[model samples]
Structures are given as C-alpha cells and as structure tokens.
Target: MKAGTNLEKILESGKFAVTAEAGPPKGTSAAVIQRKAEMLRHCCDAVNITDNQTAIVRMSSLAGCVIARQAGVEPVMQMVVRDRNRLALQADILGAIALGVGNFLCLSGDHQKFGNHPQAKGVFDIDSIQLIQMMKQMRDEKKFLNGDEISGDVPMYIGAAANPFADPFEYRVKRLAKKVKAGVDFIQTQAVYDVPRFARYMKMACDMGLDKKVHVLAGVIPIRSLGMARYMRDYVSGVTVPDEIITRLEKAEKAKEEGVKIILDIIEQLKEIPGVHGIHIMAVGWEDIVQEMVEKAGLMPRPVL
Candidate 1:
C-alpha cells in the first residue's frame, strides 16, 4: 500500500474510498474548517488540504492537514511546484512527515497571474512528474533530490491530478502513465461532469495497464445552481460539462437537490466502469451538504480506522 494511514488502508483494501477537499482560509481562523471537517467525520476516508489554491495565499496545507487530523479527518496534503523550489518542497515534505502526515498530491499549480498577487514571481523548478519522482526518491531510496543521504524514515502514499478533458485529449492517458511510472500511487482527476469522456480516458489507461498499478478516484463537484453549471462549462479550463447536464439543472425546480442527484448518478455509473476506484468529492463552499451527498450516493459510514 506504500502507506501507514487509514486512507492508504482503505484504498489498499479495494474499498470504494471517499475523499473530499476544502480550501484553507486566508486568515488564521480555524473554526470554519474545523466545523466543516467535523461534518465529514464518519463519511470520508480522507480530506485533501489544498496548498495556496488558485495561487492565492492562504493557510499552509501542512498546517491545515494537522487541523484536519485533530478534527478526526485524515488529510492528503497537496504540494504545488509553482510556489516552491526543490529545497523548500523537500523540507516541507520532511516537516509534514514529522507532523504525522502521510499522503500527498503533487501538482503544477495555476500560474501566478491568476492569483491576487500577480506581481509575485512564480517558481517552477520542477513539474508535477518530477515532483512525484523526487518524493519517491526520498521515500524509497532514502536520499534527497541532490543524492544526499537521509537517516530517518520518509514514506508517502503519493497522488497526482489528471485532466481527462484537457486539450490534445489523446495525450492525457500517456501523461498519466508517465506519472504512474514516476511513482504516483493514485490519481485524482479534474472536475468531471462528462463521465463518458472520463471513462474513455480510463479505457486507455486500463489498456495500458496503468489502472492495475494505481488507484484512480474520479473527481466531481456538485453544481449548486444553473449559474454554477454554466460557469463551469464556460469558464473552467480542462473541464467539460455537457449541455444536457446544464439543461437538466436549469429545468429542475430544486437545483441544489438536483445537483446532488447528478453527482449520485455519476458515482453509480463510475462504479460500473472498468478502471475507476472511487470518487473524490469537492463541493467547495457546500461542505455542509457532503453528508447528504455521500448518503444519497450510498457511500456513507466509512470503514472504522
């Protein structure tokens, strides 16, 4: 399983592991995050702590994961190369491990221009694939990125993001296979409102036998209203929401409920697909309704840690 946490055990046991994510607050406040994590206490296997998501400064992911752990939620800390050089990245990993954190999600963060501080210089010393390789080296080889010896233990259940709907779609699966070869233990996809497309991508991954080597959790974000759906379809890059789904949301009298239903349907369909291992739910600000969504989708009552 390459890990020692409940999240790793759940995935290692071939269970339908459920995970959720919450963007850390911009301030020192912890009440809202704690409350939201507590709401998912018994319903999820892990909660991803995003690192400076959208390039906007916020609470550090390592600290957020510690908070989540105290609140009874396992955390998969996210690390992005856009904000850190190798030294900072490696040091943070060791620090996180010292703090009892085990899981990680590597990413090439959104460009700085999209963030609040556009003038800030961005750092991309390594891409996501290289980041995964670096982490593997630290854990398996017991050496730093510079090949220096490390005395103590460093282990991780590594994860990486995949975008099935991205442009030049033919290359997406290949990129995923490279990541798996680079020691990615799991894959959490981009927001998927178009399951058929994602399934096709999975088929390619399965054909190449990537699925056998890594766990894949299809990403989904429940749309709260018609406007939300439209915005995602139009403005969200690397995500494609079919017009039919938007129409369904628009015509429904209870949009919020309908949105939940839509996610539930996606889960049901994903379960039948060949390569999908689980679902990664990201409701953004709608954290309060996650329990309802998980229950309606038949994923509640997660196995005891």
Candidate 2:
C-alpha cells in the first residue's frame, strides 16, 4: 500500500520529511519543469507539482509530475476542484496514477477572479472534502465514484491543505480533523509566520491526537526581498508576516540570505514542536534558494525515500 513514493517511505521511517513546490511553465515546456526539479533534487523528499495555481493557465499537474519524475524527484500532484467536474477529476486521477504519480493534494482552488481569466465561471461541482472521500474510495475500495471496480489497483497517498491563520481561526484544527476523518494521509498548511498561532494550532491537533494519525507539514515561504514581504502582507489573505520580519528584511544588507536565515530559524523552532512532522518550503519563483534554506536548516541532502 505504500505508493513507493519517497515521501511516504521517509515519513514511514519516522524521519522529518521536507517537500517543495514548483509551478509548471505556462507554455508547453517540460524541460523547464525538469530543470526546476533538478534544482530541488536531494533538497527535499518530494516536490509538489502545483496545478494552475492562482487560476492562471499552465501545463497540467499530471504532466508536471511526469517531468519531475523523469528528473528524479518524487512529486505530490496537486488537484483542484475549480475547473474539473466529477468525471474529469476522476479521469485525471486514473490517468495520473497510470502515468506513475502516487501522491496528491486535494484543493478547493483559488477563485478564477484572482487569475488572468477573471470572467471564467467557477466549478464547485464537488468541494475538496468530497474529493478527498472520493479518492479514498478509489484507493481503498478499488472502485470509482460509480462503484465500478478498477482493473488492477488504486494506489494513492492522499493529502489536504489547511490554513491555520485563516478566519474562524479557532476552528482550523476542527476543519483539519474533518479532513483526517474523511481520509487524509497527510496535511500541508498555509504559510506559518506566526509562531504562537502555529503552536496553538498544533497544540489543538495534538490534543485530539490527529497529529499521531496523520503527518502535519508546516508551510514556510522565504521572503525574497522587502518588496516581496510587503506584497504578501498587503495582498495574500490568511498569511501573517510579522513586522519584525519586515524590519529584518528592510535592514538586511543581503536580503535573500537574511530571508533564508529567518526561515531557517523558523524551521529550527518548528521541528521541536511535538506534532509538526516536517516542513514544506514554498519557494515560489525563488526555487533557486530552496536547497540552501534546507541545508541551513540541517535538512540537507534529504533522507532517502
């Protein structure tokens, strides 16, 4: 049942798992993806191939996974419910697994208004929770949504996203529990800039013992520059960038190294938390710095998967 994914094997061996994310190019260039994956190789246990994140069009996540795999990086394929109907979603799942993708992260996706196509209609055919359950059925029961048996096997490691800093913050842990009950094997949360808030969220999850049942990987995005920090603070919701971080970014002579240091400090503290199983570094367009950050955090040359 282990999907033969390095990530699954790393976590199964009880090592602190590290993962990164990469967006496939908007054009048909798998080479671009392969190059990025090569940069992240040996930097983390696996790389998450993002689906048209922010609703901007790009190569499919399935194709991105193929490129990453060919580059020798394990991938967690992201699936969003915003554009695909039930049939398309299931079809992609089948197709992705057939093409050797073994891990997935189910998402409700950002609304289309945020991307290039503001006029595109949204598809909420099924929410993310339902998608999680559907995949669980396919993998565990070896059946599709219509209850038809799969020809050979349905092997997948399912994950869900959570935002601890989002509104109704008091209920974030409960929402995570819902995902766990619905069959999430692992979870990757939104960016963590507030140590107190993240600790609170982990405390709650630990209280319920959800941490023991599922892997919880905290998300961290290195602040590339003072402007980037300000941009995220002003535009991104559910993300908290402390004024201290902003001040540090503003004062640093070398912004990128300072950013890496800040994130390294965070990773050091995050690893000590009881429930946090790993770190998922979202390098965004700054993929070049991921391995350095991981290395500084003492997670370098990643554990074998």
Candidate 3:
C-alpha cells in the first residue's frame, strides 16, 4: 500500500473514493480549520488543505493539516509551485512527512496578480509536473530532486490536479498522461459541470489506459445560487457550468436545494463513466454541506481500510 493513506487505501481497494476541499482561514485561527475539518471528517476519506488558493494568502496548509489531524480527519496537503522555490518545496515535503502527512497534491497555483498581494512575485521554480516527479523520487528512491540520497523513508501518496473541462479539450488527456508518466498516484480534476464533455474526456483517457495507471477523481462543486452558477460559468477558468443548471437554479423556489440535487445527479452520472475512480467535491466556502451531499449520494459509511 503506497503511503498507507486512507485515500490511497480506498482507491487501491477499488472503492469509489470521496475527497473534499477545505480552505484555510486567512488569520491564525485554528478553530476555523478545526470546525471545517470536523464537518468533513466522516464525509470524505481525506480533506485537501489548500495552500494559498487563488493566490490569496492564508494559514499554511501544513499547519491546517496538523489541525485537521487533531480534529480526527486525514488531510491531503496541497503544495503549489507559485510561492516557493525547489529548496522550500523539498523542505516542506520533508517537514510535512515528519508531521505524519502522507498524502499530497501538487499544483501550479493561481497567479499572484489575482490575490490580496498583487505586488507579490511568483517563484514558479518548478511546475506541478516536476513537483510530482520530485515527490515520486522522494518516496520511491529516498532521493531528493538533486539525486542526493536520503537517510530515511519518504513515503508519500503523490497526487496532482487536472482540468479536463479546460479549453483545447484534446490536450487535457495528454496533459494527464504526462502527470501519470511523471509518477502521480492519483488525480483530482477541475470542477465538472458539463457532464457530456467530461465523459468524452474520460473516454479518451481510458483509451490511453490512463485509468489503469493512476486513480482519477472527477471534481464537482455544488452550486449555491444563480449568481454563483453564472460566475463559475463565465469567470472561472477551466470550469464549465451548463446553461441547463443555470436555468434550473434561475427558476427554482429553493436554489440551494436544487443545487444539491444537481450535484447528486452529477455524482450518479459520474459513477457510470468508465475511467472515473471516484469523486472530489469542492464545496468552496460551503464545507458544511459536504456531509449531506455525500450521504444523499450514497457514499456514506466510508470504508474502514
């Protein structure tokens, strides 16, 4: 069992794994992270503690992971290349491992221009693909990116993000292929609102046998209101919310309930796709809704492996 994390165990055991996102608070309040972690504890195998997501500075993901562990939930620590150089990245990986963080998600973070600190310069020392390769080497060979030997085991269940809903659709699969080749053990894609398009992406991935090489978890975000839906459809990069969803929410008496129904329907449809190993719910600020969504989707009673 690679890393022996609950996420890896659930996926390796062939169960439809469920993972969720938990954004850290901007301040030093551990209570906020603890509350979010408690809310998500039983709903998902693990929660992703985001690292300065959207280029907005926040509590460190490593600290959040430790707090989430205190809340009795496993955490998938997210590391972005935008904020740190290779030395910092490698050092943080070692630090997180020493703190018992076994799972990681590598990402090229959002641009600093969009964040609270617009003047901040991005380090982008290495992109997400190289980060994956580096983590894999650290885990499998006990070696650093510079090929120096490590004294002890660096066991990590490496993961990376994918955007199947992104433009130039044909290239999405190829990009995922590169990550798999880079030795990522799992993938969590961009939020999926256009099911047909996502299915096509999966078909292409399956044709290349990418599913067999790595666990692919289709991402879904629960739409809360018409404004949110429209914003995601028009503004969010790589996310494609369908017009039908917007129309439904537009006319619904209770948009929130309708939104929940939409997410459940997407879950049902995603389960039917061939290469999908699981679902990753990104509720954004609505972390409290994850338990209900997971339960209503019949993904509850998370495996004991």
Model 3 misplacement above 4 A = none
RMSD of each: 0.9, 1.0, 0.7
| Candidate 2 residue spans exceeding 4 A from truth | none
Per-model lDDT:
0.89, 0.90, 0.93
Model 1, position 175, has a per-residue lDDT of: 96
TM-score of each: 0.98, 0.98, 0.99
- After superposition, the stretches of candidate 1 with alpha carbons farther than 4 Å from their true spots are none
Per-residue error (Å), model 1, residue 174: 0.2
Ranking of models by TM-score? 3, 1, 2
Tens digits of per-residue lDDT for model 3 on 1-305? 77999999999999999999999999999999999988999989999999999999999999999999889899999999999999999999999989999999999999999899999989999999999999999889999999999778898999999998877888989999999999999999999888999999999999999989999999989888889999998898878888899999989999999999999999999999998999999989999899999999999989898
Ordered list by lDDT, greatest first: 3, 2, 1
- Against the correct fold, how does model 1 do in TM-score? 0.98
In model 2, state the lDDT of residue 32: 89
Q: What tens digits encode model 2's per-residue C-alpha lDDT throughout 52-162?
A: 899999999999999999999889999999999999999999999999999999999999999989899888899999999999999989898899897778789998899
TM-score of candidate 3 versus the correct structure, residues matched by position: 0.99
